[model samples]
Target: MTDVRLAERPELPDRLPLPVVDNHCHLDIRRDDAPEVALRQVISEAASVGVDRLVQIGCDIGSARWTAAVVDEHPALLGGVAIHPNEVPRHEAAGDLDDVLDEIASLAQHPRIRVIGETGLDYYRTGPDGVAVQQESFRRHIALAKRLGLALQIHDRDAHDDVLRILVEEGAPERTVLHCYSGDMEMARECVRRGYYLSFAGTVTFRSAKDLRDALSVTPMEHLLVETDAPYLTPTPHRGRANAPYLVPHTVRAMAATLNTSVPQLCQALSDNSEHVYGPWS
Candidate 1:
């Protein structure tokens, strides 16, 4: 497990005006003082703040297995399974990529496995040598998601053009999402035009993220979603602290301000868009 610690967890933001879902998060990543305790604490705190549901994403074999089982224990949680783009090269080197993918395919059949994702291209991390492997894995995942009739969550990082190209070339699944959407206004418009969802994370709240805010301003409420991607990208006012689903209210409120809409209106839209993408959480 990778160690993740922040000076302290942020205090909960004001309760949301309406319930919304955390469309993407990695709860299995160890964070906070005690992981198990922190996990429950985050869930409780999130519910108290009107973040009523979450989609836990597992990008590797172990976390994918953990997610499949964990969702069974929590009424408010669902799961997504895949091998992250950055991890594709490692699995390929080990010669176990195909086997692990088969396992993920099996895990996808679980009732609570509502998504197939946290997959896509990441040019920022993977080198030229690893790009082919990542692209190949991404195509396989796209096919898996289409076959299973599940939502597809993409992790695009510094590879927006290629990611979009590949999606078009392979025919994107009906419900594709750009998790922690980092593109500008033009890209955002293109994605929305294609019927894909753009999920904003706390990164949009940073002062340096004017482009992200601009994208949010142009995005229609119907195609927008919100996420924490917690234990990372903590919103301002809590940037240095550990992020959890409870802190989602901060990002939601920021997005509302950018969109010139009321928090309640945005929350309702987010909740609706989430259901539209992932289906009913129940």
Candidate 2:
């Protein structure tokens, strides 16, 4: 019964008018009790709903290793690797931060690894003493992305100002994306003005995310992106349920409605912008 419940997936929504990419997923992180969700099934389900491509982000060491090994096995998947900010202090305490980062750098060199992040400040969970080291990790990631010419995906939570300040200090990669962007109209404006991409997650579909919608409305189509952040931030109507890339349609429809644009239009923009940011998944 427990396995059955964990195996239950949200029913597939109507197919999208055009295909899009779920650009920031952590397929490597699964709940302890959840049944193993095969990568093939994840791809097929997502493709059936017109979310045909995905970019997996592996921010911690274990997931980073998983990403490097599995990314090439599936044509539908590309990947990003970095040390998550929340994990940085732990790595620092373990005295393996440098060694772990070295391993991440090596893994990032994989051709299928086209991104250098999901790395940035996460002030919500990380305490004050860890801030400096966390910021340093973020800077190192920024430099690594520039060095490799790969896209950079940031995971910022409750540290918008510091994240932006550090991005400016270190000079963000040419293709920098703020994954699961949670900032308001003002920060969105600044990010846009600085030529960064804002990737919306399921939270934008929530009723209380008027500020997120406002940010989305003003963001130019060229600079827009979308992600599931699966296994987290599942869209409304399906809130409290486990998220997967296939569930993207709910958020996409909400985004379309919020921007007052056609679903197909937004889907096309998402696809095109993803290619621009992470290159061909094939």
Cα distance off (Å), candidate 2, residue 56: 0.8
Clashes of 1: 0
Number of clashes found in candidate 2: 0
- TM-score, every prediction: 0.96, 0.96
What tens-digit string does per-residue lDDT give for candidate 2 at 21-111?
Answer: 9999988777545566888998999999999999999988989999998987999999999999999999999999999999999999999
In model 1, which runs have C-alpha deviations exceeding 4 angstroms? 1-5, 32-36
- Residue-wise lDDT of candidate 1 within 160-261, one digit each (tens)? 999999999999999999999999999999999999999999999999999999999989999999999976788887886667889999999999999999
lDDT of 1: 0.92
TM-score of predicted structure 2: 0.96
Among residues 3 or more apart in sequence or in different chains, the pairs in candidate 1 whose N, CA or C atoms overlap within 3 Å are: none
